[model samples]
Target: MANIDSTAAIHSHQSWIGIVQIITAATCWGTLGIFSTYLNQMGFSGWQVTILRIVTAAVIVLAMLPTLWPQLMKLSARQWFGLAMQSIVGVLGMSVCYFFAVSYVGAGPAVALLYTAPVFSLLFSKFLLSESITRKSIALAFMAVFGVGLTMLGEQAEVNWGILLGLASGMCYSLYGVLGKRAMHDAHPAPLVFFTSVVISACGLLLLPETYQTYTQLLTLPLSTWGYVLGLSLLGTVVPFGLYMKALEKLPASRASVFTIFEPLTAIALAMILLHQALSWIQYLGVTLILLAALLNAVVNGTTTRVPRWLKRRQTV
Candidate 1:
């Protein structure tokens, strides 16, 4: 029994390490937006930007195939299909919509709208997972929404179709996050990411138009653009998510979700640094409120509590 307890304690410590890894991953993922703007300024089409991101990231994943192939071969068809869907929703769908929305509108409002993910995640948990709806969740949702509105600061009356696109992207990403929790079960995180990258890359390469005439343009891209794109693909996509799954293995979905508030915060800070986009006092206050709400929600749904739906589903399975 003493030996058993010792092993359990060691496992617990490892799990904490995983939590830290995921937070680091989330922060890196947030910086992708800043890079996207640079890509846009260089006259790259949205599809071109998406293709490079997926293809480059996929190459990194495929490089690990010697170690990853055995796990891929062992997966059930259902699991493989689920992983494919994760790629579609989480990578392809999220990227296509987000880039277009950012282009159509602007990054500040685009990000504010996209931060609606947590509220939608809670809703999906209630509907799909059959988790209980709590007053605390509702309050957090309200606070988050309000923060978005406050950030807009009387600009709500100027809403347009681009705003709708941003909201749709947020909704899609929310579902992606909720579904990812289940689809990732019993899978190797690195391979899962690799497979997702491959699928998204293949789809983009096949579907999106590639102009060979301007293909040489890519080679001549300014050093800064090359640096940003590489940064986006490496730090933004590969390394961060590689760490996120490790952290998710240790942390609860709800708790892990809270750390994502940093995603927008990082983007905001980067914008200020790279673009010198100044935030109004009202916008800063709104950001603070949203961050506070996220913290409150995380505290209220501590890691110890079993997500009601996951608990019930585990029993049924």
Candidate 2:
């Protein structure tokens, strides 16, 4: 009986640790908005800053390549293909859009727009992951759509290309999770991260030639600015990214998505404190609804998890 109790205790502790890792990852993600906004003010374009981040992260991973080489080599061709897809759609696509959104819209609305990822995730999963599109899932998606509409009614809301960009970023983010889950099954996170960084960096060079001017401008930044760059690369990008990938190993993406609320909340708090940004009550309500929809969907999904046991099982297969 003592052994049984001890075993259960160990499992419980492990579960909590995974939850904490996820929350910590989300918090780290929240900081990216603050950093991006700050950097933008410091004279970096959203496009430049986004590219710089992935490039910096890629350099960091390149330093570790010798150590990660073996694990990376073990990846099958299909696995590499999946990682490539994840790199294009998830890292580059999402960050570029979100940062531009932050630069265009205020951080508050940008984060609100970013949170719409869950609804996008739900839809993407049905098509990409072959997950069931039950009535409950559809209902949650509609709620999120309504929340997005309300978000557009926020104080700082502008019906501009930036708004469209934010939605695009959110949709790309959902693809990241869906693609990562599909591609990264049973794979170690470190090598995957490394590969993603490299791909994204190469893609930036190939696809975004205008970023050359941005890179040239980077050379003139003061020493203090470098500190922010390092923090953004290491803390906001790599560390949180690694933590998030690790968390996915332990928890289903559904439950993990619930904890991601900490990201926008943290982003909003930091935006207010560091950036002195705020939204009207109506916009806040919109953010609340978006978050609530995500929470409710996760809960509804959890309850119905047993019903669509095949969906969960298929993920493992």
In terms of lDDT, model 2 sits at: 0.79
What digit string (tens of lDDT, one per residue) describes model 1 on residues 19-138? 678667877977877778788888876666766677666766776767767777787887777777767776777777777666665565566667777678788878866777678889
* Residue-level lDDT tens digits of model 2 in 3-46: 99999998778778889999998898888888888889889988
CA lDDT of each prediction against the hidden true structure: 0.70, 0.79
Let me know the TM-score candidate 1 reaches against the reference structure. 0.81
Candidate 2 residue spans exceeding 4 A from truth:
74-79, 185-194, 206-212, 248-252, 306-317
Q: Weakest 10 consecutive residues, lDDT, candidate 2?
A: 303-312
Clashing pairs in 1: 18-247
| Model 1 ranges off by over 4 Å | 1-23, 154-157, 185-194, 197-201, 211-217, 248-255, 307-317
Best by TM-score: 2
